[model samples]
Target: MSIEEPMRKTEQEIMPARASQITKPLGYDIYPYYSLGDNKIFNGYSSLCDFIIEQKTVVIDGYVGVYWNKLITALKEDLIDRGYALNLIESKNYLKSQAQLNEMIAPFLGTEGSVWGTKTTLTLADYFNMPALTEIEKSTSADINIITGCGASLSDWKAALIYVDLPKNEIQHRMSAGSICNLGLDLQKEQTEMYKCFYFVDWVVLNNHKKALINDIDIFVDAQWEDSINWAYGKDIRKGLEKMSSSVFRARPWFAPGAWGGQWMKEHMPQLDRNEVNYAWSFELIAPENGIVFESSSFLLEVSFDALMFAQNKNVLGVHAAKFGDEFPIRFDFLDTFDGGNLSIQCHPSLKYIQREFGENITQDETYYILDCKDDAKVYLGFQDNINPTEFRDTLEKSNLYNEEIDIEKYVQVHQAKKHDLFLIPNGTVHSAGAENLVLEISATPYIFTFKMYDWVRLDLNGKPRPINIDHAFKNLDFNRKGATVKQELIIKPSILFEDNDFICYHLPTHKEHFYDVHRLEFEAEVEVETNNVCHVLMLVEGAAITVESADGAIMTFPFAETFVIPAAAGSYKMINKGSERAKVIKAFLK
Candidate 1:
């Protein structure tokens, strides 16, 4: 369903009012990096070219959206200027043609109107011409032979392997700018289509390839910036990752604006750009889209989150590693609707449905921990006691087709939201975060399986109608969760699990469908926490700042609204309050 563009004022004209009192200055470090040893990371094209020239044959493989043309051009000029003959083999030439790739991936792309796609079973080698790659791998007749592209490693060449990585957020930015294409494709598609291809196909194949070559990679490069490059030895990166897996760390969080954007993040996070429409999402620890940054002597390098998983999945996930393998099972993010519109009424796929349809191992079982909310804030969840499935579907479809507004509360139950309220949203439970609240969405790692039933009859940021998925929602909705059942099953009642004079822990239990549980530690001074062989995903919910000190005495300070992780291998850690008031931290771990 679609609608005509609605006339609306610019974001600047509709800015929300500022807070009356001054809050703590934003302490979120956008470029949080783990420290690599000095001299481990090298910068500049000159140094990179110098290192490549010394090797007889070098293959430079990287993620999609990396600027291979510029990288190769710079290396070619520098090597030729240094009086070395170069045999530059472009890896794209050996890949499958555009028409062939499109035909191969069509089954997974689904319909044009659909946002969901089946995870691809194809590998990087499936997109390549093996004969051509073998021929190139056999011939090395120049002073320095450089093979570079997305699947350069598939050549099976016995040479120095360098992997260039681009962050997921940067790849989206480049997609929006029309500067990059999907794997094995020559032409750029529209942003949404390109993102769909990237998510369902390109990323899946590339991540598999990268994991296979993680240990064999001799060097790793961060190609996020245009003018400069950051490179480091692969061994050093592995060492840093190993150290981090046994300690506490934070992924570099990224922010974005959306149709239902809010002013809460803009007002509290001073580092964010106030000129934007509004900040609606802060990707705190969504592992698939997040990157771990490593710093060395003032230089910074970022490798995708998968690198950490591939290198040390056992240490990071502990006993759960056996089941999840390289996948991180938990996610924490901020859904800001403060002084903004309500979120689209949506529900996620059930576990069996997600597995059969999307090939995902987990469903998006989520919980909204209300970190802050205005007095009138509310959360739409479940259905009324007298809800009719057919009638609800008819009303939603009519709303979508005719651009009419439906009385949502007539069907769905709306509960008042307050600070520290935890609402459990298992798969198939219809829910939406109402306006004037900051929701810390802690959930399973499958983040993109939402099926929106209604969108409040509003135009998106691009002035286009947002996708409505009534059919998909109906297929997965749990009508049993209605009225009294909703309150008994979804609304979390906090109970004191542990206590003392100065410290206490409150257990906010999740639903039966959820594999994880939640605990809020409120401490006036400090509290010692044991991991118990399960990784802990935590956020500083109610304190200005707190210091997380590992057993080995490595300390990292996280401020309010910051999401950090304590690996299962960490064993024990201490959270020392650095603020004037009691520190409250939300902790999520395996059940």
Candidate 2:
């Protein structure tokens, strides 16, 4: 098939009759927020200034991508109008020069041609001139001494600290629009370079800084909006996090369009923008890129997911806390290729390679759970029986360089895909989901290390040739996983683990390389489950809706296609089907 040719409509293109029964709005909440109870969430510059004027000394620190100039200008105007003298100390003045920062981070950023980079070991403090900050801390003379910027807390001033947080998705949006630059840098680069900096250097430093400051913050601000802001007391946010740690919660999901995007999400998800060509990916719960939202009456505030982990890693992760720390070990996302092109033929880095090359603690071990697919849908996986490494590499390289077609089936195995089937893809295995499939990608948290070997001679959405990592793919591809071995080891078969009159639990075994296991609980009425001291990540795959009642009797309704979490501290819970049909929920937990 030519890359530019339109895809033929398949049975999967027709929405299922059951899909009409899903009358509920998009199960994925774009603004999912937790209640702040009686605590008030302040809004607007006037309210912010009203609180700030009362404090003697204040430090307004924020994440990268926040509009520091706009925030400072609004605060100054509001505070001055209220007759308060302000001594503003901008933290950017104390930052190391851009040249110095670039030199320091260059080693972590691989090269101009590659997208991969090593995680940075540098801290926010390392970007500032500590002596200058110390001198400024001693010279605070105005009535309200305020220090503000990305690392304003580094001033060491005994002040009421307010952290302004922007969600990761919003940061990426701002980066794409060329509205923001990396921390300590004044100029914005191309979107890819900026994203590389964020993934490897900027986010790493700021996340560590945020973790260190979590305990001391007095207020938390949501700076996602341009004209308004929502903020709550830090203690109140902490209390909300504590409540969530011991109960059930869902991270707000965001969707994006891609070159090989599909129409599944655009058609089924009513709230999505249909004007886009297609929806390619939904970030269901990729911890590093997702955020938890909190609400107080009509107002909403959001904080990065790591804030919850920093505050209560033990309660959220239970026994696994010691090993994983604040890092959420598992990730859930949606890859919709229904009526779309095939995903790039790719492989992920092995455990040792990921750790050594990228400084990630875990490899991108993955599994594709076929949520929905057409009758003719397929998945490219493993290798052919007589695969030649040299020939395969040469063909892929020549195809990329000459826009020539290579018979992918000659080098890779293709398997028929069906609904509810799970395919294990441990690192080092070559894999790709073919067209006409809505794949639920469950994997380890490290998601950005894909090494693409072939892309079917297609250009990206930007009209540019996508990066092909034939060399990296060759190093990581496991040639031994060929033909019969691929079917024997990678295609998982489910077995009934437990059964009763109302419910049955089926175990879908994962690869040994995966530290997590999967269970599908199908129930007609209600099913009781135990956390067993390990957190559970779940998605309602089969039914329209189900109610999850935690041990404390707190209940939350999750519609079909919604992803949620049950913290380990929740102990036991019950899943009650709220729809006419039986409910099938996928549960992933630490092995």
Could you give me the TM-score of model 1 versus the true structure? 0.95
Per residue, candidate 2 scores C-alpha lDDT tens digits across 1-591 of: 122222221111211112122234646444455676744677788887877878868899989988887788889988888787778889999988889988988998899857889999999988988899767853445778899998999888888999999988878776665677888898878888889999999999999999999999998998877656888899999999999998999998888778788999887887665677888999999999999987775577888999999999999999999999999999999999999999999999999998998999999999999999999999999999999998888888899889998889999999999999999999999999999999999999988899999999898888998888988887888999998999999999999998999789999999999999999999999988999899999999998889999997778888888899999999989999999999999999999
lDDT of each: 0.87, 0.87
- Cα error, candidate 1, residue 545 (Å): 0.5
Whole-model lDDT, model 1: 0.87
Point out the worst 10-residue segment of candidate 2 by lDDT.
8-17
Count clashing residue pairs per candidate.
0, 0
- Residue pairs clashing in model 2 are none
Report the error of model 2 at residue 525, Å. Answer: 0.4
